[model samples]
Target chain A: MLEVKDLRAGFEGSEIIKGISLSIKAGEVHAIMGPNGSGKSTLAKVLAGHPSYEVTGGEVIYNGENLLEIEPEQRALKGIFMGFQYPVEIPGVNNAEFLRMAYNARQINEGKEELDPLDFDDILTEKMKMLSMEKKYRERNLNDGFSGGEKKKNEILQMAILQPKLAVLDETDSGLDIDALRVVSDGVNKIKSADNALILITHYQRLLEYIQPDYVHVLSQGIIVKSGEKDLALELEAQGYDWLTPTN
Target chain B: MTTTLVDASDQAESALLNLHKKFMSGNRPPEALVPLNEAAIQRFELLKFPHRKHEMYTFVNTKELVSTVFNLPGETVVSKDFIKSHVYPECESSYLVVVDGILNEDLSDNSAIQSSINLVPLKDAVDQPEIKEYLADTIEKENDVFSAINTAFISQGTLIDVAAKKQVEAPLQILHVSTGSASGNVTSHPRILVRLGELAEFKMIVKYVGVQGNYFVNSVMDILVGEQAGVTFSQVQEDATDAWHYSKTRVQQGRNSRVKAVNAFFGNKITRHHFEAHLKDVGAELLLNSVSILNDAEQVHHFVRIHHEAPHTNSTQNFKNIVNDKSRSSVDGTVIVNQGAQQIFSDQLINNLMLSDNAHADNKPNLMIFADDVKCTHGATVGQLDENQLFYLKTRGLSEKVAKELLTKSFAESIVQTIDFPGVVDYLENTLLKKLEA
Candidate 1:
């Protein structure tokens, strides 16, 4: 469903994702683990079409279309979802209203009828219930004054609502407690389907315990150093990224 | 030749004072208001139109207003449909329509609230003790030229008195409509006096609307809240593009009294509002919020002062401005805590969103605290929309324009939501969106 050929992207003039290649088919889950400043989050942002990052040399084809040419909003409508590592707090926009707007945007993209507030409330309630989110989530401002765990849960809740074909979860497990991690993992698992794919970006193998990954890729200094089955996560957790580092 | 030029210039600068003289000469004011009018005229004479160097008028340019000769507007006939179009449906039966600065009894209908409150025209109620005592008591006409001018010509105004401990269920609406004359530019002074007795509760919405032609609306409102009384006052200024609007509102709160004043400015070429709140007793609380959505060459300036004269008083002032095109907005707010007013809590914040490089916003938040152990804070921000916020919304599938509009509206929503009047929030939201889209 997605292919990245020699993806090299960076911010300003420095290269971060250097000559990386990856391909993911439908119904597959991939975990990319790396240490600090290892370009784990940069890859996710580049795929999401963040404007601050410039793609120097790369080609990303999603569903046989040049994904790089699409704008951020168009990318979302085209079924590319990026779970922000740090979701911004918009103090005045209501959470339920924002969710409805996103859902309706996708609906309109697919030539479907738009759901009004009352009609969309049912879908929101169901998705939130599945994610174990409280009713206050429906009324509070979008991520304003929300705890770190609540922000992660909100991202998963968005995933459940939008039902994107491919979701890039960046650092979703970084700030979550054990219980919040379990709940967030359960939400992702519940939404997983045979026609969609997932890319989990994390630094710890603890998240792999909750949601098993089909493939594990170790990233170091802007390049992929190792690719193996899920057991590679446990190996790295026992040791560290030092052995995987490439010597000059 | 130099003497002649100076004389001509001086004559031209005295255009407003000449207009004032013409008004007083042609009309005879009430007997009870003669001394007050005389005092106000003297004050206006001493302090004429404020110059650019004036402290309060630093950012405002009054060259055009000082040069233009505005005639006093006479009573004009207006259609019922016109009045009905501007009246809020919720206040249809309790609204007072003021046309050309005079209360239009035929067009106004206060039958629903006549029993709970005493509503009398200023000229007719001048003999009443409350009217005589509180008419110009709270406002400092000596220091403000506009307030002095408004007081000098306060023949057509309203005096509303609420009985002690009475709760006014219906929200009162004071609709000031300016219908400029075809002959020349006109000006009107609309005065409003509201006196709430002890423990009384009342809500009022004052709106300014103007029709075609060039006009000026100089308005003044003095609100006196007795001990433990609560009042909610909302003002919406939607004058014509060619109109000039100025207002001075003075509020005095007694012990444990509360006042919430919400103001929204959407129209007028040049608009200025002078707002002052005096917390005269302990436990008094004041919440002042204002939002200005300006475009084109429109200019709006707000000068606000909150006085914490008694201990334990609290106040908050939030001013937001959304300026686009070449428009400009300024907010000069100050909170003063007296020496003996200890333990007072005061906060002032000003936020400006500039959508164009040419747009200008001047914000100054000042605090003068003479007491010890008081919590006071002031801050000001002037910037464009947040790019991170924009990207976040855009990634959620909203187009850039929709995202910007939503964010701009959200900036004003915090203040608009505090208004409790029916259909007001919707009106303000729609108006703000329309202005943003334009």
Candidate 2:
């Protein structure tokens, strides 16, 4: 579903992701674990086509097409979804209206029928029940006064509504409590399908316990140093990331 | 540096002299308003047009009125087609049409609301006792030059009197349409007087519509809310591109009365609005909410003041301004708590969104708390749209233009949603969207 070849990117002139290559097939879940500032989140943002990150030297192929030239909105239309570490607070836009518009955008891209307000309400209410979100959240502004847990749940709610092909979760468990973390992980586990892929980027190995990953890659200073199975996560959790860091 | 108001331009001085001559020669109604008109003329003579050097007129170019030749109120040739096209199509209301400062009997639709209350032309209400008492009670004609001008040269207006305990469901629509003069620029002064008795309820919608010409529409409204009464007044100003508009609304609330005033300004070359609310008795309440959108070289100004004269009174002022291009807008809000008006709660907020680098927004939020127990808060914020918000919306598959329109519409939605009338909210939303894109 996704392929990256020597993906080197950065913010101004300094490179963050230095010559990292990774590829994943459909129905597979990949976990990229790294320390702070190890380019885990930068890879997610670059793949999502953030304007501030310049692609120094790299190529990204998604769904058998070159993805570097696509705009952020077009990338979204092509089923590229990024769950931001901190969702932007839009104070005046209604959450329900925003979700409906996003859902309709994808349906329109694929030439599917768009749902009206009444029909969308039924679908949205069903999804809210799945995520255990209160109906009142639909009436409030999108992430305006929501707590940390509510923001993460809102992102998951959008992910469930959009049903994108490749979903990248960047630090979705950082600010959540134990209950919220379980609920979020449960939501992602429920939405997984054989035709879609998931990329879990995190600083800790705890989230891997909720949703098993097919492959676990340890990222250090922008490059993947070790590739192993779920047991590698336990190995790293027992010993710190220092034992695995490669010497120059 | 020192400044003097006596050194104003000679052209404006001559303009004032010509208006005085027209006022003297105009026919009188032989009513109690004659002396009030004379007193207003005397006051206008004492304080000519406000100059740019004045503290209140510093940000505004007061000379815009003096540079052009504006004719006095004359014949109105407004047709039925113009009136039908100008009013809101979907909103249902009882209409009162004032064309070129003259009340048109044939164009108004008072029959729809005939059973609610008393609505009559001001000139015909000379014999009514309530109209005589509330006509010039709340407005300050002696200090405000425009108010003085409106009083002296008032051509035609309305008088709305609600009987005790009467509640009117239909909103009274006052449409001030300026069909520019055929000879030269025209100036029309349309006045309004509203009086609600004890426990009475009323709703009014004032709309200003004009043709494309060099014209000036100076409007004034006086409202008196009796004890336990509730009133809501909404004014929507969408004048012509070449028009200069000035409006002043003064309100007074008795004990336990409530008043809510909403204003939206969209189109004008230069527009200035003054709003004042006086809590005359204990437990009086006031809410002043305004929204303005200006682009290009258009200019809009708002001067708002709320006075807590009695104990246990509450007042709130919220204004949102959206400016783009090279346009400029200013808002000055002041909340005054009297010496004995303890337990008073007043707040003022001004939010400005500047879309372009050259657009200017001058905001001043002031509070005068004489009583130590009063609680008053005021703040003003000016900023561009959030880039992170834009990016978030774009990632949801919305194009840049649609994202911006959504955000801008959301900025004005909080106020627009408060309006419960059908189609009014949609009309305002569409109009604001068009203005933002323009």
Q: Which is the leading candidate under lDDT? A: 1
Q: Backbone clashes per model, in order?
A: 0, 0
TM-score, per-candidate, Cα-based: 0.91, 0.84
Q: How well is candidate 2 docked (DockQ)?
A: 0.53
Candidate 2 lDDT, B336-416, residue by residue in tens = 898999999988989999899999999988998889998888899999877778888888888788888888877777666
- Lowest lDDT sum, 10 consecutive residues, model 2 chain A, at A239-248
Q: Which stretches of candidate 2 lie over 4 Å from their true place?
A: A1-25, A30-46, A52-70, A91-97, A107-129, A132-151, A171-186, A201-248, B1-11, B89-93, B120-142, B281-284, B310-313, B340-347, B371-377
lDDT of 2 at B392: 86
Docking class of 2: medium
In model 2, state the lDDT of residue B382.
Answer: 97
Candidate 2 lDDT by residue in tens digits, A153-202: 99999999989889999988889888888988999999999988999998
RMSD of each: 3.0, 4.3
Off by over 4 Å in 1: A12-20, A57-59, A134-136, A139-141, A145-147, A174-180, A203-206, A225-227, A232-248, B1-9, B12-14, B123-141
Chain A structural similarity (TM-score) per candidate? 0.98, 0.98
